[model samples]
Target: MPFADSLSSRSPQIPCSRRQALFGAGAFLGLAACGQPHLDAGEGILRVIGPWDLGGFDPTKSGAMFSRLQIAETLIESDNAGTPLPGLATGWTTSPDGLVWTFRLRPAVLFHDGSTLNAAHTAWALRRAMEPPATLSLAPVADITSQGDDMVIIRLTKPFAPLLHLLSHTSTQIWAPAAFGPNGDVRNVIASGPYRLTRFEPPLRMDTAFFAGHRGGPRSVKGSAYMTVSRMETRTLIAEGRQADLIYSIDAPSARHILADSRNQIIAAQMPRTLILKVNSGNPKLADLRVRRAISLAIDRQGIASGILLDPSLAAGQLFPPMLQGWHDPDLPPLGRNVEQAGDLLSQAGWLREGDGIRRRDDQSLHITLKTYSDRAELPVLAAALQEQLRLVGIAVEVQINNSSDIPLSHRDKTVELALVARNYANFVDPTISVIQDFGRGGGDFGATGWVNRPVEQAIDDLLTHGDPDGRRRRGIAQVLQAELPVIPISWYMERVALSDRVAGGVSFDPYERTLRIADVRLAGGRS
Candidate 1:
């Protein structure tokens, strides 16, 4: 990929008032000029800035970063539409009954440690990945074995249509034999990819260099120094100070803040992730269908998108975003603000308005606590907005800002009344898995807590096994979600990035966040 050299000046979803980066790019540049500690800008090293930190050595833990950086490769890669493509495995096939799958490995591929890629190594990696916590464990994988140097066989207990897509997960990234310790503890990331990990500082910085032995051949930039700057302000400063060539996972405010910089390019892609409000449907107070509908009706998604996200197009009317072509229902009624309807529903649910303006049922107030995190930066603000919005409908919402992990913890403990979550539809490569895992019999931590519609679950199940060519089953899943209001759709997500002018890029925004495709980025004056 050629580095970013001739990028056009694009406006953010919400244009900043030419505040000249109201946060002060001049101050950052001045500090850099004053010998403040800044980032790298060498020709050989592409300075990459983002919010993600290296979670750990395990793929199931945080291997997504390795794959995103092109430091690791999955057996099956995915296209923008989430279709399977050749990766470590050139091609693959299944038995007539779909019970057995065989993958023909790409030959002569060398790991960063100089070890050759083989089926035995790949099989070992897959088997290890089947351990709990990885989505692969969800599949009914009966056994895994290596036949020859290039062939790996996997037998399943039953036919699983999502097996291919499951393999596309970051947890399934093939690893070198030496990547793990004798007891199978992952010690390093030694995988066959365009980039290899040369330096890793847990939960913060990762430095990678291009591997000459990569099957893709030589890369444009010799390497990349990825730094995890969690603060949006600092990330904006890095983009303006020319400290980094590529900045990933930026927010709308940061995007708007840096939009005035003509020297860089703004890359915004609608992702498969959606910001949703997860409600505890099992809670006695929120279990009523009318109350749930009231909660949905009271939401002002358009106002949130425009005022907070600064992008009205990012407002979500349904559970699935437009990015998921088949899952998003075009004809289904969209969720919107209807204060009267919300109040009516609440009244029907036996909650009458009281003097405090909070609805009361038999002297019990219609009050709920909403939990959110600040990782995304917008969630806490959105939570506050939701609090105010619900207040108008005679519902009292208490906002609590906590760590991201607390949501799941509270879900498991059956203690959460409401939670603001950003659910990623492409987590399992196929969107159907999201429906199953989230709304299935057991339910997901970030999904509808204690809510299970057997018919919708079966519809999702049949979509995989029986095939839904007519999309009737898919539409049923969407309809059930819309009607049930198990998860209130708020806004869709956008992957915002700023590419520096020092390089020219043949860049593509990966909706799946599968790969950064840094390989195509090269020096501005370098050969194509």
Candidate 2:
């Protein structure tokens, strides 16, 4: 099937003490405008603006920033296709039984702190990542040890194929021993990457400079600056005014505006991300599979893709998008809109239409609260559209726009009825890593809540250990998700970025959005 058809077919309120710090001055301001040309060759600095802020220094919590800035390195990395590539580890080998893996470290690499990259440091970083709060520890890792000063060994409880891919994640980023405090806390973030962090202000701005001792040598750009801008309009303004050289997470409308301007360039690539509605199946009203399917059938994915997203081809028919080749099941029937069927299913599930048009079972009404945030720009708009669509089927939805943390907090407390989120399935190149986190035995914060299927869990485990070559087990998992409607797949996504013409060389967009490739970026013309 053609790629297009494949996709088409188918506030939380902190205390008073936190208020002053979060809303302080200089928090939302863009960097000072350079008096020189936008891209001064002599003073090579790439200014960037994005939706996410510098939450902290912990790789496990805020690794995306570190990874994107090239201020940190992971033992493994992934290519565009999600295949494992080399990073800190030059190469790796596994034993015959596949339980023990050995990685050969690259030589002569130096951390930003002037510490040499060695096996002991690599092992310490990996071990730290496997501790609590770091999801990497969730993997079947049994132990970690170093061989001499150049090799690191990882012993796994079983043969897990996604281990390498998991290492590529930001959580497993290697840091120097000095980066941690006496108690092993992440007091600093010194690492061996192309860039080194010079200044960091939590939740807002970060500054970095090219590392002289970097393995790839000094970058053409002497330094770079990153600022967190929550408003999409502000990001567009910076891109258009050339106040910033690069801007990420552009909405469809902003993308169109940027594309029309000659001074800016828009780069977009289909990503392995799916916009989904996480459902709490434990709710008495949502406990029935038929009711869940009714809600899924009520969604007009085609309309949302074409009308809201302005990209009809992005309509998702399954949980996994076409970008994830193996997990996307071409054989399954495409998800379609059927209002009559949906109403009938709800009726069969003990819902009766009242005079006000709202369905009800006994004295309870078919009312649900959907939690979403506005940072992404599209999410709140999508939530409004979803509210309208669900109302058509005798369902009344109350949309709550809150902090991104609220969704997970609600999920943990089992109070969330529905949540709209953009789930990235390519965090590890392999879908299994995200799959296990979101849909494993116990439901995940962004995954299912109060929904469990033993067979589905077993299938995911089988894929992790045996590898889904034919994708039979993968299809099975998708089938299970489709039938149960633990999460409703709304639309696939395309990552969009706006670049100023001042950037001489082109910037590479990682489908996973892991790296910004600032090192390769230089002034449009030669040195001034």
Candidate 3:
């Protein structure tokens, strides 16, 4: 049978296991136990389960936990639409040339160590972030100095517009001076957010207590615990057993099963993340634009989104999702499946169909290796779907499931042929920052490998310095990417959260995945 015909006859099924079934059943029993719960506010501590683990104490390395738990603060904050908002710095101003920026610190703020947060501490943190092993140093910074006890001044080598957004990143999170050792290394995790670290377990668990001295006042919840559970089944069991108050990144099927129980609430929001196929444009066979477009045309994004993800709306029409204001162009041509068109494009690219239906040019077979990881549950499944879809178009794809680090490692070593990854565009509020980081000069590990578009690079440079809120320049960049197919976007992302009814107060979901909003949570039924 022809590959296309065989694939058409069979329906795509989401792979499941016995463990999933057992844990899914356990989730129902856990939900049932919540009905009789009347635990006092002091007796209950909010428990959180998520995939992110505490890598280390360095703000440049593992400060995401501190930021998410509100144990640290950055110089700037962002709104839902990626606009700059007030944070540790109440307000900021820039010089006419945009080279000099001044930030006014929030008054009377106390760190977890009881030291007042001042401009000197902030300047030291910024300087540390701009040093070795810290990714924040990639920003266009000239100098960081303190004006007084409550003000910080920054000088830029050039007019970098994403400076504020870069400051808002987790790596730039400010720490107390006491947190560092004599060598300027981060020896402790002292910070100035609403929560203070009380217990620290490297890479697995952390316990924190609400800080009374926080400038925002005490949080509604007295204390909280975070546990890193890599297995989806274990996380589901924890959520079902009511041992955990909140769980992040639940699978679509597990979410559906848990949502059947009224005691549990599933809060899902669209995030500015894209499931993309990172191609090695440097490869001999893939360097051709026709071959790249053909491979992209072979993907059934709608099928994968609707079948595996259980949400057809998640199908990506363009490189940028709708959440990214100006970058997502509605008028751009949408990516669609066309087997005949894919075959013709391959023929035009000099790929001849062989006896076994695999395409060949000269002695090289139309074969490629796809690298993906199992950390994100959907990725492997999506890789399988993509492999079969590409086979139908006479392109033989071998899917290699490996560690998440392998993708970037292979990219650096020039061993990556194709990689499937979830790229977060709003890491710094401004999508252009991530765009430049990924697609600029040498090409990012998660972006284009062997190709560079001068127009896209120039537009990104302009967007960073001049800003492009109107999106005219952003549209051109997107158009260039669409035409070049440096990275093929398959689906947008939906962040899933499971909250038990025992917890009250609202959870604010940041589309950027910056903060977890644990401070706002309180015991249900007004127990506080």
* Model 1 regions more than 4 Å off: 1-36, 526-528
lDDT of each residue in 1-528, candidate 3, tens digit only: 001111111233334478785775555455358651221224447778898888989889888888888889998999888888999999999999999999999998888989888998799889989986575687788899998899899999889888888889999988999999999988888998888998888787788888989877755677777877777766665666566778888877667656554565667778899999999999898999999999899999999998999889999989999988888999999988899999999999999899999999999999999999999989999999999999999999999999999988999988899999999897778888788878888799899899878887888889878988677998998888988899999999988777777677447688778888787776675322
Output the lDDT of residue 484, model 2. Answer: 85
lDDT, model 3, position 444: 90
Clashes of each: 14, 2, 1
Which order, best to worst by TM-score?
1, 3, 2
Q: For residues 446-527, could you state the per-residue lDDT of candidate 1 as single tens digits? A: 8989787889877877876766778888888899999998888999987777877766743677777777878877668531
Candidate number that wins on lDDT, 1 or 2: 1
- Write one digit per residue (lDDT tens) for candidate 2, span 270-350: 788999999999999899998888988999999999988878878999899887878898888888899999999999999
> Residue 387 in candidate 2 has what lDDT?
97
Predict model 1's lDDT versus the native: 0.83
**Which ten contiguous residues of candidate 3 have the minimum total lDDT?**
1-10
As for lDDT, the candidate ahead, 2 or 3, is 3
What's the residue-level lDDT of 163 in candidate 3? 87
State, as a TM-score between 0 and 1, how close model 3 is to the true structure: 0.92
